[model samples]
Target: MYPNDGFRELERAECLRLLAKVPVGRIVHTRQALPAVVPLNFRLDDDGSVVVRISARSELVRAIDGSVVAFEADEIDAGAQSGWSVVVTGAAAVVTDPAACERLARTGPQSWAPSPQEVFVRIRPELVTGRQLVGGRTLYGVDLPS
Candidate 1:
């Protein structure tokens, strides 16, 4: 059985599976020395890389490329008071290979914004971790040592 501390640690495989089911995720990166978060449409590639298609002019490309960034996606049930959150920390790189770019263009995540040109940013996950909140009831039901 897992721990009863209102959360369960998810394995790498489970985390990747959950990531695949979510369509939108937030990419956390540094901007002007401050944290910047952007909601993006993304897809998990066959190799488990987080791929996001963004406008070519987007400054995010310069801000995050060749840097360590955090990507997070989650599903929360307000009524059930339960949810799972997954975080992937890795290096973000702009795809520059002509062949790879062509393939990615064909199978795109499709930019949410209307852009004449777009590029793909691939985050090769170096660390994957997640937790599921599964004890909303248990925490409230337990008596406190007050």
Candidate 2:
């Protein structure tokens, strides 16, 4: 049998809660038949979906729509060498409905990039998983695993 791991799995509810604490994530998708990862500012919806603003002309607009994609967000403590990471995988759909778009635009994260960001894409998570590193006390009195 394998040795006990120091990482612990996070429950679904806890994963969502942790996701809510972060405003940015990396979205992985297919671009030109190759894998592509892009950073985006996003927000978590009540239904456990991730919403992000994209420009109409962005390549990701076409690459992600109607496709399955993975989104990852993490918080790391370099000094402590402990952190948590969350990955969400699901179908991504472009929000074309005017009413829905308007609602999301009002509540979604603001785009940090310079663009009109008129398009909104929603990733309805089918799988959400997270892991956190368990830490122990260090010589510096910091609670980090050696």
Task: Name the regions of candidate 1 deviating beyond 4 angstroms.
Answer: 1-6, 135-146
Q: Stretches of candidate 2 above 4 Å error?
A: 1-6, 136-146
Name the TM-score of candidate 2. Answer: 0.84
Which of the numbered candidates is closest to the native, going by highest lDDT? 1
lDDT of 1: 0.84
What TM-score, computed on C-alpha atoms, does each candidate reach?
0.86, 0.84
| Reference-based lDDT, residue 87, model 2 | 86
> Per-candidate RMSD vs. true structure?
4.4, 5.8
Instruction: Write one digit per residue (lDDT tens) for candidate 1, span 31-141.
Output: 999989998989888788899998778899989999999999999886787878888889999999999889888885877676887889999988887877673543223
Model 2 has an lDDT value of: 0.83
* Residue-level lDDT tens digits of model 2 in 98-118: 998888878877777758556
Worst ten-residue run, lDDT, model 2? 137-146
